[model samples]
Target: MMSGEVVHTFGFTVYFVFALMFTWASHIQRTNPGAGWWALSISSAFFARLLYFALLYTGDTRLIITAYAFFIVLEKPLMLTGIVRFLNLPITTRWFWFIAALADLWLAIAWVGEFDGFTRIAGYSLINTSLLACAAWLIFRHHKVVPGLSLRIAALACLALAAHWLTAPVFIQLYPAWATTGFAVGTMLTLVQYLSLLTAVLSLFQKRLLESEARALDMAFLDPLTGLNNQRYMTTLFDQALLLATRPHHIVAIFYIDLDNFKPVNDKAGHAVGDEVLKAMAQRLKDCTRSTDICARVGGDEFVVIGTQFTREFQVEEMARKLLEHVLLPIEVGGYTFQLGASIGVSLYPEHGNSLTELVQCADKAMYHIKRNGKSGVAVYGGETAGGLGLREA
Candidate 1:
């Protein structure tokens, strides 16, 4: 059987390695307060073990034991505090200090009273068990929010370590001859606890990296002002719609809308109010289209709506009329009321052109045709005008 001193030396080495790893992590992630606390916690454990190993050869058992007990009692409270901070759980500073003080007082009482070895060990072991159990409970409670296999494994390791501590006193009393073996097993459990916690921290960093990438993608593909898909994303949607249009009885319709009398709103009321108007217009466009349709802000005062899977050409005309009616509504912004109008040009798949660029060009020409005749109406690419519903007569 391995001696107790050998097990202590091995435990010291484990704590040292973990201390260095946590210190490096904290240095790299200076913004992560939890990492710093974890580094401190592990470093305290490393120092306590180092102090014990150093005093082993001094031949003064009382001084060595007292120093080790004083330093070791600090480890659990610091670890619990680090766990709370790392998980972003709400815990008061007073509570942390109170727990630390209580642990210290208990140790002082055991030492001053000259308690038996078993009594001292059992009391300290129970304290450690409670702290480790609390850490495991905290991690388990936050599993849903900070989800990862590593975190779950860490929680399990903590619970196992706590159970080991809870059984340490009984094992030591029942099988004094096997105390060395128990110490060896506890040291292994402690090593596992350190490794799992380090991996769990790395997992948290990975989650943050993924979320940042998603936000960047959103910024790249979406318009900042109106929250609509930009022209770049519209091309992708157009290609998808074109693929669906290849099916029998399926048609794609594009409505190119140019706001009439919009420039004056910007020139007179300032760009801020003009932005509000554009946002209102974007919302109206969304309200007028189906959820399957795509809406995009392609240019200044120019928007596009693409509808797919239409069975009939008349449905396109009806959709165009709905858009015209919605655009003609009065917009109220900043205590000012303004009536807006739109010149809408419609293009159909296989009738106007094949590609988005070609169809948009055809729609642009038809929109100019409406502007030449009279604004605030819809015109098809093939000279068919949708005239009704009190539209502006040309």
Candidate 2:
């Protein structure tokens, strides 16, 4: 069995180490809102342990006990609140504060007057276990959505911590002599729980890091204004679509679209309204395309659609019509209604050209044909016409 002072000092050291580690992690990852809450949780635990040691060896019983009461009431809730924040789940912090205040009031009134009773100890155990169990349930409920190994391990650790707290009261009641000894059941369980908790905290940090990296990758490939895949992503998709058009009669069609009268909207209203119109157009394009199709904003007011998995060639023309119907929908921005139009140039594999660049160039010329003749129309490239052979008015 360890000596009382040794066990207390060791536990304090562990808590302090984790507190600092969590604080540092939170500082570095300050962009994540949950990291701040997690840092507060671990820091609260450290202070609670510090007060426990002061009660044992240094401070006045009443003053130390009062400070402990306040700290203990805050500790478990802070930890649970951190878990809720980390999961991006909702929690009623007002209720937590109310309950903590009640617990503090009880401790001030009942436990501060006498230091020899087990009732206060039992109450503390029940309160701590309940809070821990609530946090464990919250974590476990998200397992289906999150399903990461770190998340699973953290949920299990929370359950173990809850169990340790719940069982502590029983041990205190059954073995009074041992409960008063150097290596009490409560102290041993707390040490184990803290070690498991440290592991859980590390897991949470790992998950956050992975999520941050994924968001960065997405931002790289996505257009912020239109929320569509950017040119770089579209190029990769274009190549994949070309490869998929391997079987006979399987065709890949490219539609190069340019919005008509878009600059006038920006000049008349403002850049903000122009941005809204772009977003609206992006959604319309997505709505018109098939799930297998890739629609991207390759440049300002310019979009591309890659149509694939089509056995019939005429389906490409129908897709072009649908795109016009959707993109021409009435858009309302800043209380002003506007109607936008598009000119599209179409190019098909094996008929227009085999390569992406040739297809794009053919489509560009066809689109310019529509723009030069009359805006708000679709033009298809074909031989003899070379630039554009077919036109459909919008």
Candidate 3:
């Protein structure tokens, strides 16, 4: 083998072996789908590049270069496709993928007859234009779905690859003396850039995995539907609130809210719309409470708010009014709006009970009374209230 051929073989073999190993690791990155696609797409580029170099080095100039050139054009398209899917493209547009794959095959076949570089140029134009369009659509339109750091790094790498190939014709014109140096420099720079990208992708994935694990751990004590602390979390938050209530100066008020007709919303809307409504309602509920007060989804369409350090019951009373106003607002689904009402029960800590269990029970019973009387009103625990008839257990 020629010295040039040996160098090409060595370089490409190293590149592809690394890429091959990365493929396995990328497949396992289910947590960060963006990183997975970024890795796989980049690995594809290296795999194609390795084969291209190997073919060129062995002097398989006719068929191999033809195949390699077709592959080179396919690279950007494939990479953008992966990125688009990762960033959450509408699944209904799967037709685009079929079209892209067909373009690759057509280009591969169009190069077979060697009818000049015209067909290759045409093929390259199709692939390049499509890739640019896809990339632009992904970055601009789907910005919300993609994480910031990964997007910037990945977009740079893709742009770099596209720019590198766009300027390949200029380099192809190098004089014999300048050719080797120019090619070596270009190759080394390209390798270093892509290698850096690979490492960045790996780092991004590791960080994502850690965050996912943390979220998973948090979810273990969280209610997924309402994005609230679960029963387990309630126990913990209550205990902490309990300690705060022990001081003679401190008072905590618990407001328990139950939906009047929430079952029909879920039953009719299907789980997806129900989920959306729950998430929407959750945001509204959180907005009504102070940050110092803890609000949690205690059950299906049931939420509990613990208001602490509020000087008077009227402060909690005002909060309850705002909570009702927000929850009563219409939630839209498929261009149609529906309303859900709330039944609120209020109980004060230390006054209601000294323990977490008793406080919750009192609040829960007070909530049931509001529901039993008429589902749209609030009930406060105390002899000063006219609606002591509204409380079942206070």
Candidate 1 regions exceeding 4 Å error are 1-6, 28-31, 58-64, 105-115, 149-156, 267-269, 383-394
Query: Which is superior by TM-score, 1 or 3?
Result: 1
Per-residue lDDT tens digits for candidate 2, residues 220-316, read 8888888888888887778788777888889999899999989989998999999999999999899888888898888889999988987886788
Whole-structure CA lDDT of model 3 = 0.64
Indicate which candidate wins on TM-score: 1
Q: Could you give candidate 1's per-residue lDDT for residues 1-394 as a string of tens digits?
A: 7776887888888888898888787776433566677777777777776787788889865556567666666777777777777877777646655665776677778788987767777776777778778778887777665565666776787899889878977887888877678767866776777777787777677778898899898888888889888998999888888887888988899899999999989887999999999999999999998878999998989999998889998888889999989999999998878888999988888787889998898788778778887788898887335662222221
Q: How would you encode candidate 3's per-residue C-alpha lDDT over 1-394 as one tens digit per residue? A: 2344444555556556656655655677364454455455555556555676656646755555465555555555555555555556664335455656776676666656564444554555555555655564565555445345545444454455456445554454443344344335434544654454455446657777888899997888788787777777777788777666666667788888887777887788787887788888888888887767787887877888887776666777888888888999988975557798988888887777776677777777777777887687777765335644334332
The CA lDDT at 202 in model 3 is 63
**Would you list the C-alpha lDDT of every candidate in the order shown?**
0.80, 0.73, 0.64
Ten contiguous residues minimizing lDDT sum, candidate 1: 385-394
Residue pairs clashing, model 2: none
On the 0 to 100 scale, the lDDT of residue 36 in model 3 is 52
Question: Looking at candidate 2, what is the lDDT of residue 323?
Answer: 86
